[model samples]
Target chain A: MSLVFAGACSHAPGITGRSERADPKLREEFYRNLGRIRECLEAARPDALIVVAAEHFANFFMDNMPAYCMGMSDEYEGPIEDEEWLAIKRRKIPGNPDLSKRIICDVMQKIDLAYAEEWKFDHGIMVPLHFLTPRYDLPVVPVNINCQGPPLSPLHRAYELGRTLRAACDAQPERIALLGTGGMSHWPCTPDSGKINVPWDKAFLDSFIHNRREDLISYTDEEIFADAGQGGFEIRTFLTVAGATEGSTGELLFYAPIPVYAVGCTVATMAVE
Target chain B: MSLYCIQKLLYQLNRDPYTRQRYHDNFESLLEEYELTKEELGAIREGDIGLLYVMGVNGQILMHYSALIGQEWDEYIHAMKEGVKSHGPVRAGIYTLLKGSES
Candidate 1:
């Protein structure tokens, strides 16, 4: 099997255990969920991982923000912007530039989508990765989806992008695991910013767990942002991941509306059959 | 004025050490670069979050500014709430408190 595994999780700074010391129960549950996902990754044993995550202006800003960008460098630098907050030791994650270049070439030739290279890993990629590849040994291809600022790509478009990613992975020789990271729902920095929509978050987790693709794709970006909160835009990453695992089933390993981090945290894995 | 202008500056301030150094060296000179009103400048100078909120600054921008000034996360959230009461309704941006007026 080319695409051996698929998983998604939220990446908040608080999850780093640096600043927001989450309650014992919350921390335990979060760690347990993370451990469970790590177990799956270990079992899948993919040669390389293609990680899709949202960027918080860590690499790109308004001056030059790409709707989607891929890293094709041999060595990808980790997060440096929020070292104290994220608590991730500064280092370079091993990169699989050849695989990244292969996917880039495939997308550019097949779908006419051009992606920039040389981007670094932000907290979005590094935080979840700390659990997935604690040794920092897995070769990674980082793809950044812009969900931070306005003028976001449509949810359908993100799903389409995920499909494109699947096609690229299928074309490759090595086994690959796709990890889409970010959001269940929690607006960051807004007035009612930290407020969690438990019902909405639960509905999202249920949809993923049951593989309700139609229901998940039905909600437009506007609806998500309005009801779920602005940062809910990050859920677009999950939609993209779901697109990759078409016709596959998934299970929600864990989900919690963690107020400490102001994110409706969740972890789910999909079959890559 | 423009929430974009407010946010852009804050974004830069949060990320750019050089700009942050510039801000610390001379707040007015840095303020002059952006199209901010006197009220906005005053709020920024005094770290007057309530005025900034009332003047239509976005929460995304306001939160970082609060942190830069050393306001704890809870205090930062409370400041925005207090801003609504002390300064009146939110004038603009997405966080413009409508009914609850607390956000």
Candidate 2:
């Protein structure tokens, strides 16, 4: 078996984990999208999944944040957003340490990338993982991109990182799937956190799934930030996945502007030809 | 003055239990370690959402601090809305409401 699946997921626990009594429509649609990803994973039957996501100060802080890092731990700690209300909460998520270590060594040797032996899974990884592999049965290799502050990696560089990840995965024998999770524009921690840029999000989705716009991959961090807010930089996740599956076109499995989540929730699976 | 410093402190508190304990043990002294103005320190110690919102703490970091202090989700969110009324437009950062009333 080889690398069979690649996709991107939006992880805003506020929306995905909202109370049942809250906007029923948004919550229902959110899960429906999650279900779509789950179905794809089941169909692919990947032995291990590689999750590329940004850390929300869970594992590292401004003092020392790596540009890109892979977790080589046997098990990752928590959903980090440990508040009782947010629906997505798990004490620990299993990790494919063997494969994770393999990718780390591969990346370090091949791409000269740095890595950490331990990393806690925050909402970025856990939220999507909860939806993708709910039972925690499937092992995960978590990769974190620095989307927290400035000195961020360039968009194209993120894409290149994805390509490197693809190579690392291909070197392994287990059937592996790649998933990038974060952002469709809902700025968190800003006054506009309550807002969602529907048109911006649509354009991004259209470019990825329908139009196949090459230029979409080149959009700079400033460009994305100007259009979707700083949080939109999380789209770097999508860029990496797209870069890894360069020739493949994606199918939009889910799209909904969930205001409560303060994010334009979207998910898609790519079929590399 | 330094939103970064404010966030750094809060971020540490959010992630590290020991940091939280130290902060709880000596709020004033611990806060002094950061380069914060009186207004910012007061807002943080008092848990003044309005003042902190006006002071321009990022919501991602601020929301977790609110939770640590036992504020409900809706209340934490609303405090931000009320922050605009009580303190004024966001003082700085990405959330800073720009001119022309554009949020």
lDDT leader? 1
* Model 2: per-residue Cα lDDT at residue A183: 89
- The lDDT of each candidate is 0.79, 0.78
**Model 2 chain A: worst 10 consecutive residues (lDDT sum):** A209-218
Candidate 2 residue runs with Cα over 4 Å from true position:
A109-112, A210-213, B85-103
lDDT, candidate 2, A222-257, per-residue tens: 666677887887877888888778777888878887
User: Candidate 2 local accuracy as lDDT?
Assistant: 0.78
Q: Candidate 1: list runs displaced more than 4 Å.
A: A17-20, A109-114, B53-61, B88-90, B94-103
Query: lDDT of model 2 at residue A140?
Result: 85
* TM-score for each of the candidates: 0.89, 0.90
lDDT of each residue in B75-101, candidate 2, tens digit only: 887888888887777777655433334
For each prediction, how big is the interface RMSD? 3.7, 3.1
- The residue pairs found clashing in candidate 2 are A189-B59, A189-B60
What TM-score is obtained by chain A of candidate 2? 0.93
Candidate 2 DockQ, CA atoms:
0.43
Docking quality of model 2: it rates as: acceptable
